[model samples]
Every structure is written in C-alpha cells, then in structure tokens.
Target chain A: MRGDLPAPSAAQIDIVEVGPRDGLQNESRVWPTEDKISLIGEAIAYGAKRIEVASFVNPRRVPQMADAEAVVAGCANAPGVTRIGLALNLRGAERALATGIEQVGAVAVASDAFGIRNQGQDRAESVGIAAGIVEMARRSGRSAQVTIAVAFGCPFEGAVDRALVIDIARALAAAQPVEIALADTIGIAGPGEVAALVAEVRTAVAPLPVRVHFHDTRNTANANIWAAVQAGASVADASLGGLGGCPFAAQAPGTAAGNIATEDMIYMLHRSGIGTGIDESRLYRAGRWLDRKLKGSSRSKVLVALPPGS
Target chain B: MRGDLPAPSAAQIDIVEVGPRDGLQNESRVWPTEDKISLIGEAIAYGAKRIEVASFVNPRRVPQMADAEAVVAGCANAPGVTRIGLALNLRGAERALATGIEQVGAVAVASDAFGIRNQGQDRAESVGIAAGIVEMARRSGRSAQVTIAVAFGCPFEGAVDRALVIDIARALAAAQPVEIALADTIGIAGPGEVAALVAEVRTAVAPLPVRVHFHDTRNTANANIWAAVQAGASVADASLGGLGGCPFAAQAPGTAAGNIATEDMIYMLHRSGIGTGIDESRLYRAGRWLDRKLKGSSRSKVLVALPPGS
Candidate 1:
C-alpha cells in the first residue's frame, strides 16, 4: 500500500542493507555464525538484494564478525542476492576476494582524526588502501564501492573542509569504483549540505554512481538521504530496525545511535512512489528479528506502528 | 556546539517553543498544571525567547492543559520572553486573549482528511477560523501565528497534494498571521519535499516569516529542518529533546521515537558555528524536568547524553 503511493512510477531507488556488518559490529553481543547467516537470509527474503554480510577485519578487533567467510559460504545459495564483504586493509580485501562474492566495499574516513580513530590511517593512507582494494576487486572482476565516512561534518574535526572531501572523491574517481558513498558517520549533515556535497561529487565523479550513508543520531539522516536522492545519488545505506552504531561511537560522538532503518526508508520512498525493490512486509519481519536478536524493541516508526489511526 | 555553526550573518528569525501547548497537549500522562508551568519556566530558562505556555482548548477535551491560565502566569516574568497561548477556535482565542499573553498561535490542518479526524472541521471552515483569529489579533495589536498541521502528508489521504497545501497557504497569506508554521504533524516529509514546500511558501508569502515544526516521526525532522532553513525558512519548532509527537501520529514515520530536541537543533546549528543564542545546558535541564514530571526519561538524543564526543 505504501509503495503504491505518489504514483507507481517514483520507486526507483536501491537500498543497500548494512546491518549484518554495521549493525553487528557496533553491538557488544556476538551472534553465532549460524545466527548471523540467518540474519542475512532474512534480509534477502525481506527484499535486500545487496547486503554487507561482514567485515574482513582482524578478529581480535571485531570478534563478532570473525566468521565472515562462513557467513558468505552460507549465503552462497541466496539466489540472485548479492553478498558484499567489508575490507579495511589489504588482508581484509584478499580475504573478501577469496569468498567468491562479486562485490566488496572499502571505507575511507574524511577527517584525519576520525581516519586515525576509525581506520587506523589518515586520508592519504586510506586513499591508498582504496586504490589497492579497487585494483584487487577489478582484477577479480568484482564490483567495488569506496565510501568516504564523515564526509559532511566530523564529530572530531567538525564541518570537514569541502575541498578535502572532494579531493578524496576525485582520487577515488580515478580508481573508478563501481560506486562511491558519502557517509555522515556522526549524523552531522543536513539536506542542504547533502545536496551541495552530492552535487559536487556528482560533478566530480561525472558518470559514476554515488551513494549516501547517514546515521539517525540527529534525526536528519533520512532527510539528508532524500537530499542526496534528489542530487542524483542513487544508492543509500540503511540498517534494519534502526540497529547499528559503534558502541564506542555511541558513547562518545553520539546523543542517539545507528543508521536509518531500511523499512522506514522504503516506506517513505514507496509513499512518495519512489521505486526501491524492497518488500515492506519482509523488511518489517527483518526488523522484528533484529529486535529479538538484540533483545530490544525496534525503533523504525512505520515497521512497528500498525496504521495511523490504529 | 552543533548550534555554534559559523555562517554569514543570519536574517532575523523568530522561534516559538510549542512544548507546553503542542508538546504537553498531546501527551497522555496528565502533568499537573503547576508542573506544566514550571516546565514552561524551565523552557524559557533554556533560551527560548518565545514560549508557548499552554493551550486554551476546552478542558473537557484536553485535561492536561486545564490550568492554561496558571501556566502562562508562571512563565510571564521571564524577561525578554514573548509568551504565546494556543487558541484552537474563537472561544479558545477569547480565553487566550483574556490571559494577557501578547501573542497566540492558532492551528488548522490543511488536509481535509486530517482536519476532519483531528479538528472536526473541513479545510475551508478551519481556514475561516484561522482568518478570524488573525483579524482579532491584528485589531488587538497582538501578533498571531497560524499553523497548518499535516501540511506535508496525511495519514488518511496519503501524500497530500503540494498544490493543496500551497493553495491553503496562499489563502492564509492574505490574512497575514505574523508567521505561518508548516507542521509535519506526522513527520511525513523528506528533504526534497521540505525544500519544495519551503520554497513554495516563501514565494507565495514574500516577506512573512515561515516557521517549520517537525515531528521526527521519520528520522528526517532535523534534516528537513535544515532543508527548510536553507530554503529561507529560518525558524524551527523543536521540543526540548523531540519529546512529543501527535499521539494520533505515533512513531518511525523513521525511528527513535521523539521530536527534534531543541538542544539538538541548537547544538547542530551552533556546532556548525551558526548562531542560535541558546544555551545547551539549560535545554538539558528543561528536558530533565519534563521527563521527571512525566515520570519517564526524556527521549531527546542530545539532552540525555552529555555532549557529543565527551
């Protein structure tokens, strides 16, 4: 019913599910590899065609996603669904490539402080990492997406110089990643900033697709996403049930937490008649499952609330 | 520091804190009239130059605001504060005018469906009420603000036609309420929708100030507020911590059940080095008092949390 809104023609956006990696990575709980795989399968059923299953980071650091390979192996039979893995370094990239997944996502933080805090590298270093990962993914004939986190405003540095973000985006443009996503990692962006940056990046990247990732920390993530949408950025990242924000980040650079919910975004787009191939009912179920797994109630307004008057 | 955002000198903006009236009116738990007044005083303490202390609605319908007169009396002495009473109709307006509050706000839903469900009136009928209230206020040399609730989207009718909202806004423009606030009564707007509407309203009402009230029902309130801000609508209506929404509207119209926190908005704008003339610490206190009076925790992200990256 929501999808039939505005009109049937507006639903053309694609949402990439980031909960299995972004969601799980932030929680203190360690889901069993089996449970993690089940989460992935549920997301696929709930209309997640492309899902970031796990990050190939050091197990010592992110003990929860240590079984990245197993999760992908389990998801090998997910029909037409695309399972992407996150890679932080060369080893992570190599491990991701070996999983036979056709796509991999590499992250680069925009602020030097956050880059050191989050990526253990500064801007230039992360750019080099992106280049390496892009080369490997290209060699493997797989799709690569490089995301620039904190591209709008940084919790550490604050209002990152636009020139700096564009410079990295321009460099990543050369690597020719299948996509580049600008992330408001701390939820510091507004729609104007989103539009301005996305417009700049769209021009900088020319024909390349751009995606925007936003955290609902300031309650503006979805609007920023919409701003990005109008600016010609076709891809967006959302977590189910609004799950996932780094616990450390949640304690520090946060007043609230997590990425926008998948179903909520779908509902808005659907209501506006924006085309996203996600199934709302399935996304609702995925939200329910994530809520149970996290032992918490979901925060997605539409997924849980029955109807307006109800 | 989010409110500390640096920017070119801002055009003068007027803010109306609707917490006591809009925020408390819809809350289910009946806060005592005295506690309500204390909340208003605290809201004023938090740098709200304009505060809506209470709604002069019928006590039978809204028992929470029964002592509207007393609430206004309590916050009257806060120096430099402009107090506003919520007047729903002619009777309500008379009661508010009798209380000696120099300014009052009147509301009507633009969507016929919403008007019937909430106001028990048709769109045209409600607009007439608003026009009458504006005339009365003007004759009395009192400033009035007429708000169009559900201006973005309606629950029963789905996406409200922009043209319809625009037309009603056009009609209201003729009466010239000191300000016209567009309410996302249910938090149904996205950034693109927000930008388009703000631009439309600005063009329609040349020099009159436009205020935007958002219910972070769909995690887009802050971003939409930002969009509205850049669209030349400078004033934003935010509860202490996004504490309330239309009980009729409910939640994740995105996630994280709440309104956009006043402190959060001020912080967002402030940290960007924008000037809000608000103190974050005072906002936290107001939020805490509201939470205590309600016998629950404040749902505001920034108010409950200390400071981002603290």
Candidate 2:
C-alpha cells in the first residue's frame, strides 16, 4: 500500500450483475434461451450472487427475450443465486410471480416523456402500477424492487428535478419494497449528482438499502458507482459489455450504445481493494464473447485494453 | 434549477483541450494537417482558451503528427488560444519552445515497465528529462506543465501504488511548473480513489491547481472526472471522438480507446450547471465529424445520442 493511501472501507459492496437482463435485452443479436442461462450460470460461477435473470415483457415487443420463463427456470436451481425479473405492467408482474421468482423489478422513468415512451404510461400511472406490483409481489410472498429510470436527467425533458425522484422514491419506499434503484437510463449523471442523489435517497429511505443503475453511455458509470457507494448506496447495477439501453430511450435514436461494462466496473472495484468478489479475467472474457456474438465491439476500455487475462 | 439544489460553486473550472495534440495524434486516417487547424479553430471559437495544439515528438515515431511545426504555427496566431505542445525529450521541448508555444508538457510514468515501454525511459530517467524540459521552458520564459502518465495503474506494472504517483507529482511540482496532470493512462480508477487521490494531491501541492487526464477505457472517465472536480481538480484533459491511446499504453494494444469524450464531459457538467464554456452542439459535431474522417466511431454517449445542432 502507498504511504497514507485510502484504507479500504468496512462496507461490503454488493454488485448486482444486470448483464443477463440488461445486457441481453439490449443486444441486437439475441442469444438463445439456453445461452442466456449459460451466461447467468457463468456469472454466478464467477462470484455474482444477485443477478437479474430475465425481464417479463410483451414477447411480441422484445422478441429477443420471449423465453423469460426458460431463463428463470434455468437459474432457479443455480447455487446461491437470486434470480430476478423485470415487470413493467400488471400482466408482466403476474407472469413473473407465476414463475415463483423471489425478486421482481418494477420500473418507471422520472420524466413524463421518458415514462410515456418507455412504458406507455404517465408518471402517476407508473407509480400506481409500482404500488400494485409491490402488493402483488407481497401477496405472492416475494419481494419486488423499484428502479426509477432517468432519475438524473432526461433527454426529452432535460434535467429532471431530484425532488421528483425523491418524492416518488418515498412513495415507493412507503410501499415497503425490498430495494430501490436510481438509474441514469441515458447516462446523464455526473459524479456530484450521483453522490448527492444517493445521499438524499439514503436519508429518504433510511434503513432500506438503495441501489444505483448506471450506463457507460457517456462512459462514467464506474465513477458514479463509487459516488453512489460513498453516499451510502448499498448496491450498484452494471451490464456486461456495457449493454442494456431501452431501445426507446433516446441516447442517439439510431446508435447502439448502452450500460456500463461489468468487467470495467469489477476492475475498478477490485483494484481499489473493494470486495466485489468478481474474477476480472472471467468477466473480461464474458464481455468479449458477448460483444463478438453481437458483432458489436465492447466500449469498455479496461476490457478492450487488457489482454485475454489481467 | 430545482429549489432543493444547492447554490453552484464559483470555481473557475479549466478545460485543457487536447484535440489538437492527443486527438489528432492517433487518428486512423490522415487529416491533411490543415484539417487539424480547422478543428482547432472551431474549439477556440467555442471558447476553449487552453488548447494543446501539437506534439514535438519525432515525426517517424508518430506519423499522424508529422506536421507538428506547421500545425502549431497555424494555431499560434489564433486569438486567446494558448497553444501548447507535447514534448517527449529535451529535443522535443527545444523544438516546441522555439515555436513560441506557451506551455510544453513533459510526461513521466509511475511504473518502471510502462515508463520504459511508453517513452523509452524508466521513471527516474523520465523525471530527469522532465526536469530538463522544465528548465528549457522556464529559460524560454514559458510555463512547463508536466503530466505523470499511468499514475493510477500501468498496463505493464498492473497496480500502481498511490505513493509512487504522489512522489512523482511532488517532484514535478517542486520544479515550479504551471500545472501538473495526473493521467489514469489505463482508465482503472474508481470514484472513491479518484476523490481520495485528488484530495491528497491538493495537499501535496498546496497552491498549484491540479489537473486530471482520464481515459474512458472502462467507462469510468466521466465518473472519475466528477470525482476529480469534487476533490479539487481544476483542469481536465479531453479529446473529441474519444480518440488517442498510445499503442503501447495498454495490454490490448491499438484499440484507440482512451480519454473521456469532451462532449460527454461538457454535457454532464452542463447538466450539473457547471460552466465549461464549451458549446455542446459544436463539441458533438466535431466528435462525429472526426470519427467520420478517421473511419472510427466515437464512444461518447452524448455525441452518439444527441441530435445535430443540439
């Protein structure tokens, strides 16, 4: 250790690998259902405990992930893995609950335009659905997490008021859900904003754990992860090969860019002496393999810059 | 601005534009030298007062910068643009100083193997060259700005101790340079580390304004930039199109993946209401056009996501 360098924090950082859900959802060349299962299995094998396995959405809309059932079933028996699913609507929630997945995710955007474009609903309607979904998850004896998308700034509405996000977060927290995640859906957050928002949410949620979901869309996810953690965010979300942008979320209407690369995030955390429990070598390989399959080169600098193994 | 938002800082954030030097250096296709001048013209027009125009390294070493002298000469007459040059050795510094550039950047690396592979010298030898270059710059009545590359972590040496980086920064600061930039040459810094190191360096060099140079290699550059600013980094180095990593700087060489995109940085800052004086529209245009010309694509989320004339 360097003289007077920062000592490692006593906090145990939890990295919720969103590659299976976020990464796969954004991939143009969809992997077969079995391959998706294998990917999640691989991640769990590499020390990822909490993984977003699949999203329960309209099959016609996202043809790539029509087999949400299979992905969930594939990971149900995986050792020490918490399989999660995304439920955008009541039908999605009902379907996800039917799978008996312990954790389900309900999502909404902070901006009206983004919420409309992303979920075909207004902010109030999305909140209503979040409340209903929380109730459903509870009735089913499962826990659901609410992720507020575009919590930082929105492309359509510009800068979103942090108060709006916090207000909605308070509402969702009142529902007493298991977790809440603040997302930079379009990658518009700065480190200061990340710190401030996480701190605010931590206070609002009190003892309830808060999470951060970031995109490398502007290539700042890793730093934001740290900022959120510093502000007491318990967990962070990342996509493999930095994948997972809402096809409807306009980063560039025609561009193919998305979330923060898992390998890059893992590298920063591991090198900083934070306990992420991830193997950098395996993570890099997964990113490379995923990108190659999609005919998209990874945008993660660490994954691309390092050799096959760190 | 939200009512809950805190009053913005009056900090005079400085942007050290490297499009002319770092951006043009690793371009895949030739830029006819004059094209670079046009680019520089656009940046200065967009209020970039501190522009690094060219490098005085051997033409054979970096063929893209073969016309360093002509490029500097052309940009030298631009109003309010402080043209600088990247100098590798005393010869480069002598040549750069002869051209009337205000600042000559001398680089040293923290890691031994990277220092040798990157600039053909070890840390001590590079320090010696840096000292000599500083002497030459001071003798010519110009300012010397030394950049310690691979300060965060080097590709060859792996994990770089913060102490080595601090020692190099202290030694360079002792030489009375106008500024010292800490380069995360391989882009592996976390937000916590970025903030901690910047805070530490602020103490290491009491009054000198510290700067940071980051690579978006792992999509953490923006986060690191935010952390740097919050931790007291006054200036940041950026390039358009997310271009400019030395072929030897990383384990996965020749990826052309380094530096946070200037447009991305400005977008994040502007969203946070920090004034960079850079027109986001112009920055995006330059990034897109540069990518088109180089047969390369930008890794900037803002550049890729935002509309033209935005």
Candidate 3:
C-alpha cells in the first residue's frame, strides 16, 4: 500500500504580494510614501509577479492609503511586474485607471450587513458595483479581478450562505474579470470549509482562475490557503511579516492578527515540493526591513526563527 | 466539478493533552507540583481522554519534571481518563511503571544525531530501547505507545528520510504498542509532506493507528495537523497555551516556538466538522488560567482573539 502511493507533482503556485496595500492600511501609524515604494520594490525583487501596491479609497477614510497616487508613480518604472490597485467604488476605479496601473481589483461583499457597513451597499449592490468596475477596467484594457470579502463567515451575520457566495462569483464572472477571489475577511474559516467553497466556486466560474485571501486572526490562514490550493485555487494573497487587518471589521480589543506571512507561506510551499517563484531568503530580509521600518517585530514565525542575516 | 465533490464526513479525533509533560518541560521556570496537578485536573475537566501527566526523566536534566511521582499521585483517582507518563530510557520506564500511571509513552528518534543528542543513544539504540520499554510495559500489564520524534525534520541532520521513518514504524509495530506517533520534534514540516508521510506510514503499520505531533515553530503546525488527519491520522498531540520546546534541540536565539495550542486545534477540528470530545469554552477558560499561572498570554490565536470571559 505504501509503495502504490504516487508522489505529488510539483506545481507552481502564484502568490499575490499584498503587503503594500492591505498590509499597511491597518497600521496605527502612517508609513511614508518612500517606504511604501521601497516595500514594493523589495516585493518585485523577491520575484512577486503580481502586487497590490495601493488602494484608491478616500483619503479621509483611509489615511494610510492617502498617498496612493504617489506610491503608484514611484513604482511606474518597475519592469516585468503587474501592479494592482484596489478600488471600492467607481470613483476609486477611475482614479486607479487614471494612474495607468496594470491591474484593477474590485471588492464585493458576501454578507449584506458587512456590505452595507463596509461600503454603504447591500450584497447585490456590492456585486453590481464590482462587476461595473470590472467592465470599466476591461474597456480601459487593464486586467481586473473581484474579491468577495467575508465569503466564509461574517461578524455581524455569523455564517454567510454558501449559495450567496456562488451567486456572487457567477455574477462577477459575467463581467469577465481576470479571476474571482474569496476573502476570509474576519479569518473565521477552516480548511474543510475553504476546500469545499473553493471547489464549488471554481466550478461556478469555469475558465476563470480562483484566488484566496486569508487572515491569521484565528491561526487558520495557512491551513485554509493550503486547502484552497488543493481544491484548485491558483492564486493566494499574502503580506510581508503578516501585517494586515481590516480596520472596518469588528475586531476583539488588542487582537488584530494579520494576514498570513509571505515568508512563512513560502517556506511551507517550498518544503512541500510546491513551486513558488518567490525567494524565501529575500522574504525574510524584507520582513526584517519592514520590522525596522515599522519599529516592531514581525509576526512571521519563520522570520523570527531564522537569524537576522541568515 | 464542484457538484460532484462529496461533503466530507465528520469523524471523531482523539486529542492527547501533553500540557503537563511536554508543555512545561522547556520552561525556564519550574512550575510547582501542585500547579502541575491542577493542570492535569483541568485537562480532565476539559474532556481530555488521555493526558501525559509527567515525564519520568532525571531531575538534574529536566528540573521541571522533578516531581513526576507526586504529580502522578495527584491524578491517580481520576476516572475514565488515561494518565500517561513519558519515559526516555529503561530507568525512566521503570520509574513510570512503578508510579502506576495508566500509559507509558516511549520515544524513538528518526535520526541518529538527534537520538544521540536527545537521549544519549543512536538511532538503532533508541529503537531497541523504545521496543524494550514496550515489552516492559506489556509484561507489567499497562498500555504502551511509541513516538518517533524528529520524524519530519531534525535540527542537526535537517530533512529526515521517509524510508527511514517507515522502517522505524514497522520495527516499532513489532513490539505491539497501542499506536505509533510521528513527531515534528523540531517543528519543521509542511502539509504536503505530512499528508504523504502519514498515508505511507499508516499503510506500513496496518491495524495500528497513526498519531501526529507538531510544534508551531514555523507556524505550520495547524496546517500540518489538518493534513495528517486528511491522510488518516487518528490522534494528535497538543499542549495547552502552545507551551512546548525541546531543551536538547539546537534552537535559534530566543526562538523556542511550542506545540500547537489545544484551543486552536480544537477550534479547527470542530469547525471542520470533526469531533474531539473536548469543550471549546472550557478550553479557553483553562487557557486563561494557564496564562495567569504562567504569567504570559497564550500562543493560541483563538484564545488571544476571543475575550477571556467568553
């Protein structure tokens, strides 16, 4: 029985570096635009093919993203990298398009309560807006994608309906976005839920790739990501030093566990014989640099376990 | 494709609470024998069926386990709960058997380097000693189990060979222990590796169950545990508050990441529709109590994310 088991094939996994946008948005202190540019550059040098560099939201609402355009302009000279700008509305989409970023990411909420609280729209309305953003990006010859936030569970509504997520994915697929993503906004998903949902959504939107974003709030992010990949999700979103949280989401006091750390993710992937084109050493270095810039230790265990210069 | 995917059936998973033995052994400060008894009683209250209450090792080497007999005596009257004692060598095994504990856990090392360093025995010597301990337990009419430490990776030798692990498992199976466990002694393993190894080992040791033990050194413990279960591992070892580290293993400076927290493990297992016979609310309460006693916060993300009272 042991001899009959076949070895798992090594497959390339695409990692979307979201350290600059999703990572910094929740920090208490605002990072300088120059540091944001440097982080983006480090991500590119570490072989991140696609990076979410900035979010074109209202400056007053998200002060950390106020220098979005400056950060975009700073990375305009990078070669062989697709720069993605996240947009929550038409105005944000237009702003991202005007900046000539390579890709535009649209947001759709899976729960009505979170949808209304997060962006003043219901579930259907959020999906419609996200589809419209995809259409706008398509017309402008830019790649576009949609991420269904809180698709697994919602803080206000508890468990979101799985059928609702399928409907949202099918609706977003009509606009022909590059891919559809499921975001565990509050990080309350387990591996089984992730695998089942990713498989269902992958079938719901055939020919379109599936991406996954997870928070490490409950320490299930890495397991959820691994399950998604096993269930046919091709793209995964991660942050440097595991630095990310949703400022709009209701969180426990002093308990803001961020997104899965890129270094830790890469270490697991590479050790498991999966091919991720990112450099683990560079990720550790970038995490250390971010730690110095942020004036705090990184939450990444791999970064903390390995030596500073190793 | 998604429609054809079957819903995974819920299964009962056995959780072996090792808080008293593995959790406190690596702590610099020695906990009182009374506190150790309290911890054991709390584990029983939380529905832990089998608990490793103490290690019959040298007091000079591991001062935390100095009062192993006293601790065992404290929990001797607990009904329906199997109190396990970990023994490293013949002397330790004799001591554990004399204490009248319910189970004796013998540890064998997968790598020669770790075996020599951890127990002053090489690979063959460790296996012989563990097998001898199993015989001793059988003659003494007590249940025994064997754990192959560093089965995944070693701090000194690095990646351990899968074939060597299978051979060790098969050799240990000849001793007729209750079960065999694969321990990531240095906390270095990925989900993919865990799934493949567990499947192969389960086959190699047919009729005997496979248990898994992981440390959260690189933050992959939860993922690894999930994968092991998917691959047919029936039992898992976890510590309260994620408190464990090998005092003999080569570790990075100030980087002694412990085992997966029992609360986090229970949350993931229960959320994934698997039953562990453990109460989640009681786990959080016990974790809070442990935190107060240890004078530190728990490493469990769920414990940290949820409120203390909840």
lDDT of 3 by residue, B52-106 (tens): 9999998998899999999988876577889899999999999999987989999
- Candidates 1 and 3 compared: the better one by TM-score is 3
**Native-referenced Cα lDDT, model 2:** 0.76
Go through the candidates in order and give each one's C-alpha lDDT: 0.74, 0.76, 0.86
Provide the lowest-lDDT 10-residue window in model 3 chain A. A247-256
Q: What is the C-alpha RMSD of each candidate to the true structure, in Å?
A: 4.1, 3.1, 2.9
Candidate 1 lDDT, B1-310, residue by residue in tens? 2232234234344466777777776666777877777777787788888877888887887798888888777665567888888887888898888887978788877777778766677788899898888888877888888898888777677777777777878888788787778888777676556767888888887788788988766555666776677678978887774556542345433121356667667755554344576766777777777767666556565554355423
Q: Give the runs in model 2 whose Cα sits over 4 Å from its true position.
A: A2-4, A8-10, A245-257, B2-4, B7-10, B28-30, B246-249, B252-257
lDDT of 2 at A160: 87
lDDT of 3 by residue, A1-310 (tens): 2233244443778999999998888777798999899999889988899999999999998999999999999987577789999999999999999996999999999988888878888998999999999999999999897899998887788888888899999999999998999999888888888989999999999999999998888888889988898888989999998877532232543223478899888988877777888887777788888878867657788776674457
Decreasing TM-score order of the candidates? 3, 2, 1
Please provide, for model 2 over A27-120, each residue's C-alpha lDDT reduced to its tens digit, 9 standing for 90 to 100: 7767898889878877877778788999899888888789999888877656666778999999999999989587889986687887887888
| Interface DockQ of each model | 0.29, 0.47, 0.50
